[model samples]
Target: MLTDAQLLAAAARFGTPLYVYDAAELDAALARVRTAFTDTRLFYAMKANPNLTLLARMRAAGVGFECVSAGELARAVKVGAGGSDILVNGPAKSDEEYAEGARLGATFIVDRAEEVGLLPPRSRVLVRVNPALEVSTHDHLATGAGGSKFGVPLGGVPAVLNALRAAGHDGRGLHVHIGSAIRDATDFAAAFARLSELRPAVGELEVLDVGGGWSLDADLDGIADQARRAAQVFGAQLWAEPGRYLVAGAGVLLSQVVGLKATAHEFVLLDAGMTELIRPMLYGAVHPVLPLWPRSEAALHNTGTYDLAGPACESGDVLAREVPLPRPQRGDVLALLEAGAYGAAMSSNYLTRPRPAEVLWDGEWRVIRQRESVETIWAAET
Candidate 1:
């Protein structure tokens, strides 16, 4: 929701490879989800952009946190999230995760069956069940496929429940997360329908968490209705964990084009690439480019095809391919749209490159996270 002027202004002040988040967009996204799921409690999946500032904002907005690691749990705690406000989830959780999660009185989302044994006795829990259905997303993002490692198969839920009961744990209900960026609304219906079949043997429940994997433009009204109906059948409270959907569209990665090159493929080299935003390189994510020029709209009419290459040494360092943009110069700034979620959260110091700074645009530009310093990159080393 930021104008080109605001984006360019942030880039100019904060430097290239900067992340700019629109506060209005964030509020709008939360409002949409709340409106659609009027009765359901919404949790923000912290893995999608867990900047402390952002987490604090979400917490202030009365959004709960879904943490998958010790660090994320600590972040939630730092932001004053209580046990009831946190849902600890992850496959192969670490000892620290269990210990911290237990100490904080957070609900554990049991991933595998054996995880039940590791939980604190009589702990509140929700067993994650894999629907094992195909969804419209990248192969790596498909957690519900038959062979996926995310959750126990659909057939294994009853046994896990029995185990939870045997272990003296308070297993409230069930949890099912198909995958990320699921484009099909029918996927939710089919998956939920399949899950509903287990209601007979599973019996009445205390909660039914229909995990979130909705696309930015997914039909929330339809999805929320399906989820609510499933929860109603179980006579339980509905819960959801929306990760990327809440934050992806609110962000833009500001990268300066270093230059153009003519090689085996035409390339527009950028300072920000795999290190800054790896979603594109990781999963063929297509981030549209917007050149910061008064005549940019006109320039799109006169375009050229090129790969938006990054400074990474690998040949697969291209962020986007066959991108059509006006010829870019060495100092041209380009805004990569929809780089918010999984953008800064997944960035790394690969090749000793420092991660970019992040700024929030509420009304005025506010520095949320300063760019990582060079000395701090290796300060942890001996």
Candidate 2:
């Protein structure tokens, strides 16, 4: 994590409405996962925060890339990732994505029944198993829920694997991603135990990817122990695709207070809103706030609560609700914590709001991604 002085220096130099990431924190997060799961291969889920520079860093650290689209694959390639270093995943894939995956020799995560025919010849594959177990998290975040359109159901796994082998592809093993932000460790224990039941069905395997959804405060070693048991049952290597867990705590969205409103409810409107960080609105995520601007020692005693609001027409643009603060004023700066993952990747130019710039802190501030210009957003449009 960056110090308050460092965050303020970044805001002063780069202006408000910017993202600041700590290089040391990123390395530490990766180390924590590696230290916990010593024998497993780690793949940083690109959808979380796919900054090219960050991708290059992960690549340099010997981490593979898990991409869901052609663009993400290209980002991996740009960072010098080889074909075998990428995993092409997602249920609804395009022909172009297939072509790109094949051209790169990437492994395909077989999702549904029909994908068997669409895969490239002799491609290595892992059939995704939807555990269909109810885990503790938002419904939208539960990719393995009973009706979620992510992976094939447990029963359908055999058919997909059989079809994959029949199509002359390398049926390496099985994959199960219960969901993201998982709260219950038992959820994983159940999924892994259930997968062990497939021993007679899947037989001995090469890779057992128990997909990552372990919460930030999760018992990683315990979860890893459960995963090891499942992989040992098949005598396979374990793989994890951690998205939010790796980068969420290492980044922050630095925005300034534009004005304060006191109506039906109080709001501290800022330039960064749903356009910059939507996890709050999309997933009911609550991000911690840190005040950066100097507050007088006298007035510091008078603290108040405010809902951090963004500059959007929709009322849902509120980034956080009922946040305690020191009565922020115009031009005051604040940092939205735990925004490294999914914050930038999910940001849109909705209502023509140009995205904020991103900076990385590695003893000094470096701009990884520059702020988007208004013209560029509409330049591609007719």
Candidate 3:
């Protein structure tokens, strides 16, 4: 939990539309998960928030990493993660990524039959099985459900395994990820039960990669119970790649109100837009937006609903719709809560807006990522 003063100070020093991450909060989230899943091997999905500072902290906490690309693998290595401590998972891995994974001795979560052929001889691999389990989440985030491009279908797992064996790769495990932002433990349990039914075909599983999709407010105890059950049924080591669960609440995006519009519906415009934080616009996701400074009694009592919007040209750049807030004045800062997950990771520079700076606050504040300059943004152009 960041204080309003702290947020204001950060915004003042680093400039508006900045990202602030609480290191203590991140460690606490990790602790909570560890306490719940005592025996499960936890892997931090780097895609959630890949700031090097955060990665270094995760490494210090003894958590392994789940890398989805060559760039992520390099980040893991840069953060001092051992080759064996990394797990490579992605549907569109390049030839270079496979060779790099082989070089790093990382476990590969094979999403397709061809992926197995790409692995090094006798390399450790886990077949990602798409069980087509429907999870209570956004349709676009659903991965294990039918028609998803994430994993090999359950019926296709055997063939993938055979191909792995033929390629001299060690096919020793199974992986399943229903979707992102999963809110129910039963969904995970059901997927695990389905995996149990396929045990006969998978054979002697050594690892069960129960992939990550946990919501920010998901029930950890229930998830732990079901994960334990899955471990028992499969007789294998339990593994989870938690991305959002470990980091979502540890961050906040700080934006300052630039202007106000007296439209049919009141609009509070901010300097931050889709380029700085895209979740709200991209997935229609809702993030709690609160004024940094306390409002007056009269302002709070006489509040009206306003559409909180950004500076982007797109009409979809609205962050919150018809949300009741005390009247916001220009230059007032707002904090977008629960933004530690996909917030910064999925940000883009659309409209040529430079990305914002990122600060890590443990006991003190330090800039982790500096605000991008226009020159830096255009440095690659010929």
Clashing pairs in model 2, backbone N/Cα/C closer than 3 A: none
lDDT tens string, model 3, 1-382? 9888999999999998999999889988999899888888888999999999999999988899999989999999999986669999999989888889888899989888877656777799989988888888888888988888988888888888888887888887899889888877788888888888877786767888888888878888888888778877768998988888899899999999998998687999999878777887777778888788678888789788889889988988988888888888899999989989888898888888888999999898899999998888999999
Instruction: Give Cα-based local distance difference scores for all models.
Output: 0.90, 0.91, 0.87
Q: Give the true-structure RMSD of model 2.
A: 1.1
For candidate 1, lDDT tens digit of each residue in 84-106? 89999999899888888888999
All predictions: root-mean-square deviation over Cα?
Answer: 1.2, 1.1, 1.2
Looking at candidate 3, the ten consecutive residues that score lowest on lDDT are 113-122
Tell me the TM-score of each prediction against the true structure.
0.98, 0.98, 0.97
lDDT per residue for candidate 2 within 200-224, as digits (tens), equals: 9878999999889888889999999
Give candidate 1 regions above 4 Å deviation.
296-301
Better of 1 and 3 by lDDT: 1
